[model samples]
Target chain A: MFDMEPEVLERFTWYMREQSALTIMFHTKVAEQMGLSATDEKCLDLAMRADGPLTAGRIAELSGLSTGAVTGVIDRLERAGFVRRVRDPHDRRKVLVEVTAGDLAKFAHLFEKAQQSLVQVLSRFDPDEIEVIERYLQLQIETFRKAVINT
Target chain B: MFDMEPEVLERFTWYMREQSALTIMFHTKVAEQMGLSATDEKCLDLAMRADGPLTAGRIAELSGLSTGAVTGVIDRLERAGFVRRVRDPHDRRKVLVEVTAGDLAKFAHLFEKAQQSLVQVLSRFDPDEIEVIERYLQLQIETFRKAVINT
Candidate 1:
């Protein structure tokens, strides 16, 4: 690691905290608009972010909810038409949760707005600066994900 | 605004989405550690991030919860000692939610760990790179906040 100034660290910390707060608020708003409870929406997000459909047990582990609670969440999500549970193709005995493409299409506009904001922000920097910013983002995401998982 | 390559935009979009998901998971873990529901913890976070104490009405607006629901959140936060309801000093008739310093001290270690993660990430860049990264973060936060508020 390189040497860092204390004030630099302090300012970066403030940025991280502010971003966290904003992210939480944005999710709350998105959940509200989707007509799903925040918990249920968050669960669906977990499934959507995964590379493949996730088992209920895996979701419970990732979300820090009890297995029983996750079951109820999955049930509610299915009832809301936001997600569906299906038997895993490779593992016949396993059940997996998947986000419904048809239902999610309704919210494409909301997601598009978010993407536009990112584009607007990135447009401020030149290609080289964007590369540096991208490097920082990759490192920040990797480091923070490890920290969150270990927490 | 400047022209941007499509792939660059796509990569940055993925970073934003990943970061958002991680932030939500981090908040969920922190809330679980504090023994509060995610919604209640989120409301408390809004109060903590504000420049001053927030009235129940403001919390309701910011959190996208009804005033009645915000009342319940404040009650739970108060009972759990994460926050307290106090009469506004300037307007004794108006009640405000205040994050209790003494209670928050218990989570100092957790916040400190997050700060350390930021430091680890920042240390990878030299001062000039750090400045650029900081600029990116500042703009990203401001633009994203506006988008969240409007949404």
Candidate 2:
């Protein structure tokens, strides 16, 4: 039953593959421009978006990175003066990560510019089309989240 | 003009960002499983999808990677036993990249399984909805492609 419409399935697969590649290319380019690895950039993004400094474990969870991986990413960001690691005053065993103000000022323009570029590209589609894509993506992410939990 | 529903715009941006991260996670997982770097895995994918062995320049162009970057990717793949660098017989100046049989066999199963996983996730949406999402993605890619070209 699942074997229906081989050609359509193939096209869908190719489309997904190409879209994925294009995304990687854009990310790599932006990361290079910022002198950061893609992972490090993502960690900084997660930190900046948080309401306040977040614990390492929370950052790892938010970024969908492992704790050990987040540690390395934080280390790199710290070395680059983009982030700082602070010991949680109340809980000595916990450490909080925060993006540096200097880094925020440096990256803010570029980040906004990137979003503007993306918006311009997406402007080709009508509002309804954009809404459909956004909803579809949300559904896709939820499905993956469920898969991860079940596994 | 840019302030058209700020909340909706923010949601759209987050959707793109999350989709981008999801793609990187998917590629990174597959590459790690294959004992290859993400870039090398991408080169192998391009070679497999191409009709014949591709020149470094062509691979770089098709992959949206710089020629020098593609060279480095091919070099790593060559070292990892997944791909071989072949000099064009007729045009000695051109180096053609080809995937190894062992690598192809390994990638074939992984690729199919990944596609099945994606299809499973996408299947929740009706066919019309899937088509709408696909069309939006195609338009997005085309817009980005033109941006790259114009820039």
Candidate 3:
């Protein structure tokens, strides 16, 4: 690590705080647009990000919700068509929460706008600069993940 | 604007999604550590980010909650000592939601850990590279704000 001025660190801290706040606000907007509660949208997002549909208990564990609460969350999400409950074929007794892409299409425009914003931001940088920014993001996420776990 | 390959754009899109998801998870942990619900934490976050205290109506508008719902939110936050409702000095009838920093200090260590992670990430880059990263962050946030509003 190289030496840096205190002022620079302070400014970077502000930037990080600003970004975090904006991220949550953007999510709130997404939840509102989809007519879902923040909790429900969070569960659906978890399902979408997972490699496969998550079991009810797995979502409960990851979301820090009780089994009963996860059941209610799944019910609400399924009723809204954001997610569906499917019997896990490998274990017929287990149920999985699957995101419904068809229903999610309704919110595509909102995401597409965000994508456009990203594309526009990237357009400003050259390949080398983009590579640098990408590395920064990758490292930041990985470090934060470890930090969150340790916390 | 510079042109980029489709695959490159796709990779960046995945990175963006990853970052956004991790942000929400980190927020969940923060709320849990602070003994606040996600909704209450969100409102407190809004109050913290604002230039000054926000009126109950403004919080409702920003949070997309009804006035009655906001009243409940304020009550919970105040009871938890995360925020307080203060009479607006200029307008006696108006009440403003103020984030109580003294109460928030209980969770300062969590934020400090996040800050340390950010510093560690930035330390990986030299000053010039750090400048590029900062510029990218600033531009991305500004563009996203415009896009979110236009949508």
Candidate 4:
């Protein structure tokens, strides 16, 4: 642990807050570009990130949507060809949501543009400096997930 | 332009996507805890981040809501005491949306926790390394705003 000054902490705090606001704006743009409501895009993002296919119940739980509302989200996503409902072989009664469209790849140009922007920023630093930034990002994400997301 | 291999770009891409998803989830949690609908919370976020108070028309344009729909959103947010409508002094016909709630301070614990998490992460690096991380953050936010958010 290191003793950092209050001003230093404040500056970092502003960075975090600003990054967070930009992230929300970026995702809003992403959802609009995808022609999905923010809620639907968020659900699709949830399903896409899961290690395995997620059941509707699970998505509802994760997204804080009602079971009934999740049904509607699945319906819209299905109609848009973004996802498919499949029965779980292990549990025949459960309907799992799977992202059937490489719909994400369709947006690769946008993501790649974002990646390029990141590349441009990273290019300014030397390898050793990049290492420090990478370490900070990795730790920030890990700690945020544990403290905020999972909590 | 520095050459970044596919693997490095890919890793950073994952970080961006993960951070985006987590930000949405955190906002959802904030909304749920605040008893505001996601749309209202998003609009509130927009107002809170604006350079000054926003007109209903600007909110509509930014939020992708129709004028009528924006009226409803403002009604709900106002009733909930999260925001208020003020007539612009220079343009009396224009109504501006203002966030009136000290309500965010009520959520200070959450922001404080996030700040503390950041403090813990920064403690791992020396001051010089911290400066590098700060520079990267400043550049990342600037580049992202210009390249992604504005576009």
Candidate 5:
């Protein structure tokens, strides 16, 4: 339904592909630093980002990993002190995976550096430009998620 | 060196994190469809993105996988028809990993869908806003890469 000039479309595609590669590399580094395998680190990220603790099944769904694989990830994460298994208070029979707060604080410097880089990038744009950028990010994320799900 | 309101920074951080998570999931699904492990696919990606064929040592460096691990990844990818090893023309004793182009073309629909999503996102903005977004993406990629490497 939307039309873009071929060259412009090609440039944007390159940017998206570059961003994707860099993101994967960033996660690999983060996972290495946390002493967790990439899969385990990704599962922990799912738990950390959730509004509350997640069941192993929920993490499996979010990470696109098998339930059995998620169980192993949780086991390793628990041993690494990055997460813990707790009975869901709202449902006593349900086990939930919760990220351990204090331990992740040790990795603050890494995330802070990322935040600082973001601040630097944002600073170059005025309020109006920043607004446009924000809108673009929101739309891009929404559209890309739909594309990925359909894939 | 730059200042941003706490809330704006927080929002941007959330976007970055969400994008990162989605990218990982996309890679996982793509790998599953290609019958390769996530790590092998990542290595193959490194080879594919290079300007020319890469030696196994180069792939190992770029992917953060050990040399031995990269060897296994190459072996698997070769068997799966995603990549092949060839003697470097400049030095016959050296082996290089090269992506097999025809096979990846079979997955064009997935990538084309992703490209279409980008087109849709960009079509919402005027030319000036598109320029701002492009600059933002370039800086974000550069700064994020530095952050990732330093991490």
Candidate 6:
């Protein structure tokens, strides 16, 4: 017997696309407000999401962007004063990229607004449903990573 | 009583951000594969997703892009042979945009491949789990639409 129904798969794909579209719209709005390009916003986002200062290679890997592409992103971000490149003490050849405090402060309100909006939108779901969705998203992310590896 | 737990809300926000990252990656991959920019791939995708020739205003509205941005995207797509603009016979002030047959064929294969990959990834869930996820996503999309309207 099939583990999953066909309609389920269909809906999942539909949801993914719809979610993708919403995200694009949100980012465009935020970027326009910040006077930043989409890519520049992404670079800043990646830097902010990092646990600590990250190398360009690591950012590229996490972002599924090419190393060369990440280099350009870093260059642009650094030039915009959103991020800085600090030489790694342990590895002379490695440059750690960090999001500036100013950038974080600048985007703080936008992030807060987005969070509030999302929280309101999701206020209808119960804990169990939210758990299921979270698990499904985790699986989706893992699956994407595996696909990239296999490819 | 609150329907959502705090953790659930936090997870939902994280999921949204993760979904956003994945979309940017997917768009970048598609663009690179077609030797196009992200905007170009989006223009093609928008054209393909449309039921028929769409006006510039309609495309901009549906794409969550500004009219000027849509015009630029159309120019790039036209130059790349992916789309053409047809002036509305009844309304000279309006132009209708359509995907070229070659572009349609190309995007058909691409869409199929993406669907297959997504379906494979979703194959891990049981039937009930899949339905739950789908229902949850449907609700989320509806909620997002409401939020956008309210905003």
**Which parts of model 4 are misplaced by more than 4 Å?**
A101-103
Give the candidates in order of lDDT, highest first: 1, 3, 5, 4, 2, 6
The models' CA-based lDDT, in order, is 0.87, 0.74, 0.87, 0.85, 0.86, 0.74
Error of 1 at B22 (Å): 0.9
Minimal lDDT window, size 10, model 3 chain B: B142-151
Query: Candidate 4 DockQ score?
Result: 0.71
Task: Write down the worst ten-residue block by lDDT for model 6 chain A.
Answer: A142-151
Winner on lDDT (3 vs 5):
3
Cα RMSD (Å) per model?
Answer: 2.0, 4.1, 1.9, 2.1, 1.8, 3.4
Question: Per-residue alpha-carbon lDDT of model 1 for B104-128, expressed as tens digits?
Answer: 8988887777777888888789888
Q: In model 2, which residue pairs have backbone atoms overlapping below 3 Å?
A: none
Going through the candidates in order, what fraction of the true interface contacts does each contain? Answer: 0.84, 0.33, 0.73, 0.71, 0.78, 0.40
Q: Which 10-residue window in model 6 chain B sums to the lowest lDDT?
A: B142-151
Ranking by TM-score: 5, 3, 1, 4, 6, 2
Alpha-carbon RMSD, candidate 4: 2.1
Higher-ranked by DockQ: 1 or 2:
1
For residues A19-112, could you state the per-residue lDDT of candidate 5 as single tens digits?
8899998888888888888888888888989998888788888877788898788889888898889988888877799888999999887688
lDDT of 3 by residue, A11-85 (tens): 888887777777888888888888988788888888998998899999998888899999999999999888888
The residue-by-residue lDDT of candidate 4 on A30-118, one tens digit each, is: 88888988889899999998999999999999988899999999999999989999999989989999898576678877676787788
Off by over 4 Å in 5: B1-3
TM-score of 3: 0.92
lDDT of 2 by residue, B103-133 (tens): 5575566566556666776766667766787
Best by DockQ: 1
Candidate 5 TM-score over all chains jointly: 0.94
Predictions' DockQ, in order: 0.77, 0.38, 0.76, 0.71, 0.70, 0.46
Candidate 6: stretches off by over 4 Å:
A1-8, A57-81, A101-103, A148-151, B1-3, B60-72, B79-81, B146-151
